[model samples]
Target chain A: MHTRTLAELGDALAAGEMSSEELTRHFLTRIEALDPRLNAFITVTGEAALEAARAADRERAAGRAGPLTGLPIAHKDIFCTDGFRTSCGSRMLDNFISPYDATVVRRLKSAGMVMLGKTNMDEFAMGSSNETSFYGPVRNPWDLDKVPGGSSGGSAAAVAARLTPAATGTDTGGSIRQPAALTGTTGLKPTYGRVSRYGMIAFASSLDQAGTITASACDAALLLEAMAGHDPRDSTSVDAPVERYADGLDRSLEGFRVGVVEEFFDEGLYPASAAAIETALDVLRSLGASVKRVSLPNLALSVPAYYVVAPAECSSNLSRFDGIRFGYRAENPRDLADLYKRSRGEGFGAEVKRRIMTGTYVLSAGYYDAYYLKAQRVRQLIAEDFRAAFAEVDLIAGPTAPTPAFDIGAKTDDPVTMYLNDIYTIGVNLAGLPGVSVPCGFADDLPVGLQLIANHFEEGRLLNVAHMFQQETEWHLRMPGGEFA
Target chain B: MALTRRQVESIANLARLQINEDEIPAYVRNLSRIIDFVDQLEGAGTEHVHPMAHPLNMSQPLRADEVTESDDRARFQANAAAVEAGLYLVPKVIE
Candidate 1:
């Protein structure tokens, strides 16, 4: 029961083999027993989950339940759940409970998916590793000493450990896919604006996207189907018709053209990671994909460009957190300036402060053009490179990160080393393309991820390709041992 | 392309972030390295490229203005360090 895919879970629910209440209890017990070790959840809404699960069971009894009707799914702490604390792993929002649901949460509730709990993340979804999370870091279920990639580390760790069959995550720059890569879970970041962003705690709005970390690509397809859609509430939400993601899982990849970015396989990448990616390419080749070496020369500039643009946008978005608002306020302030400074100083973690400072500096009067404007222009060049490359290929493939999961404190002090982890992924966000990290092979007893990237609004195709690959491999089926088994 | 320690201090002061003096060297080194890398963009030919801030160019639609939801200010402000009469109380701004 614990190892069944989401589709199987749905079938079981429909067949009365297990009630949603029973499934929810099973997961709740697993979370209670395991979360203390993983620190995956900041707030576990057990009572709400049980209540929602019971409602799903009632809906199933009435024969009105949707495909994911009774399946339990957790949300990253970034999404606002009306009655639950939606802290984006920041002390600034540690006590902030939203009054309304984020669009993704609302859609999931409407679909009757059980709300398991809120997973932990980096402060404001800013860091590459989960170490910057104010609640503490999430331990990779595969190896406790290794980090689960972040800011969606908690979501990836939870799903990998079988705390829940699937979990929601958000990526700005490589939050979802990178963490999913490290934890050996399937996570997808839909094209920009595909999922509405209203009520998602804003962090680099242009780059931020809601996605899922699940055990299989099929499970991700189901979760994506439930989550993707336009909402008038989010000004940037693309008004496009939602597709049946799970319906095309068994689609043949006979004519698929997989582009292997030559720049991605350059000197900086880990040798083991490079080998695993080559093996994944072979799998695609076996599935009849015509693989070719493509070059996106501008990708080399992505990390530097992303740092400027993301922080600049983040600096603007996070300005709303001043003590005058609903979040945390400073104590014993003699004046407004002191209040503002102390509140932000005390509330934000070290990494958050560092980013805020960097963002503020770059966007300041004198440096805006040299940094922010140049980054945006470079971003356009990178996007154009993808556009040109996609004209010759159907999809792009590479290693999600340069290496497998590193030790917890390995890159904590070195911000550049941490930023480099997103080198392969930042380009996807920069180009506004959809990308996924599927477990392909292991390096040094840790999981390595094969990254699949598709053109904008090509999520269905990407999922189909991933599902086809997953169908022939059992990597996604492997799980860590614990009470879950 | 390295930033001087004085420049780092000035930037930190301008941003209102209190960075310890000892940490300035590392921050300067790292930030300068990144800045130098991004500086490579200056050589790219972007003269004719209109800076694309967003992928899609569609304009946002407007709806009739109305309050769709509300939060209890008193309850919401309950977690704040200072508050008074359904408003967040900040330190006195007027001298």
Candidate 2:
């Protein structure tokens, strides 16, 4: 019951073999027993979950069940949930019980999915490793010593450990994909504006996107169908038609053109991870995908460019957390200036503050053009590179992270090393393309992720490709202590 | 491109963040390295390249100017640190 995918769970519920309330209690029991070891959850709404499950069961009995009815899923704390404390894994928002539900939350609830609880994440969705989380790091379920990746680490870890069948995650530069890579989960970051950003805590407005982490791409398709669409509340939300995503799965990958980025296999990548992805590409080839090496000349510049653009946007977006209106406030401020400074200083974590300051400095009077403007131009070049490459190929494939998960403290000292982990995944966000990370093979007994990227609004095509690969390979089905270890 | 202690201090002030004195050196070091890192973009050949603000190159969409939302001022203010007579209270700005 715990290891079943969303489809299997849905079938079981539809067949009247088990009640949603019983299924929810099963997962709730597992979470209570296992989540303490992983630190994957911030708050577990057991009472609310049971209540939602009971309602779903009652509705199912009355013959009104949706595809997602009675399925329990966790949401990364970044999204606001009415009445639940949407901490966003930050001290500033520790006590913030949102008055409204994020569009994603509302949509999923309407689909009859039971909200298990809010999963932990990096503070303000900033770091590449979950260590920066105010709730503490989420350890990889495969190996407790290594990180699960971030800022969506908690969601990834939760999904991987079978604490939940699926979970919601947000990616700004590789938060969703990287964690999914390290934890051996299927993570997707849809094209920018594909998922409405309304009520999701802002990180980098342009790059940030809500996505899903599940046991497989099939589950991703099911959940994404319920979540994708436009909401007028988010100014940047694209007014586009939602795809019947699950309907497009089970398609064959015959004659698919897969492009391998020449730069992604450079000297910095881990050899074992490279080996894993190479074999996965061969599996794609057997599934009828023709492979060719492609180039994105500005690929190496993504980290630097993203650092500038993301931080600048975050600095602007995070300004709303000033102590007066809501969130944490410094105690006993001597004056207005001190209130502003001390409140911001105390509320934000080190990485958040560092990003804020970097953003502040770059957008400052003398440095704006050199840092911010040049970075934006380079971002344009990066997008152009993708544009030129996608002209010849249907999809791009690579290893999601340079390697599998790293030691918790390994890259904390130098921020650059941590920044480089997303070296492969960030370029997609810069260009606002859809990308996914599916479990391919193992490195050092840990799982590796094979990344698949497509042009903008090509989420359906990407999901179909992933589903085909998943059909040919059993990597996505390998669970902890099943075969690898 | 390395920032001095004073430069980081001033930037923190500009951002309205109260970074402590002991943390200044680390900020100077990391911020300098990051700034230096982005400096590589200086050499990229972006001649006549228009800086991209949106990924899809779509202009901000305009909607009909009409009231689409109802007033939820009291509900929204429930999380405020201090509130009075339908308003948020903050440190006094005017003398």
Restricting to chain A, the TM-score for each candidate equals 0.99, 0.99
Off by over 4 Å in 2: A482-485
Error of 1 at A117 (Å): 1.2
Docking class of 2: high
Clashing pairs in 1: none
lDDT of 2 by residue, B30-67 (tens): 98988888888889998899999889888787889999
Ten-residue region with minimum lDDT total, candidate 2 chain B: B86-95
- How many residue pairs in model 1 have overlapping backbones? 0
Per-residue alpha-carbon lDDT of candidate 2 for residues A1-485, written as tens digits (9 for 90 to 100): 97788888999999999999999999999899889989999999999999999999999988899999999999999999998899999999997889999999999999999999999999999998899988899988898889999999999999999999999999999999999999999999999999999999999998999999999999999999999988888878888999999899877788889999999999988999999999999999999889999999999999999999999999899988889888999998988899999999999999999999889988999889998899899999999999999999999999999989999999998877788888999999999999999999999989999999999999999999999888888888888763222
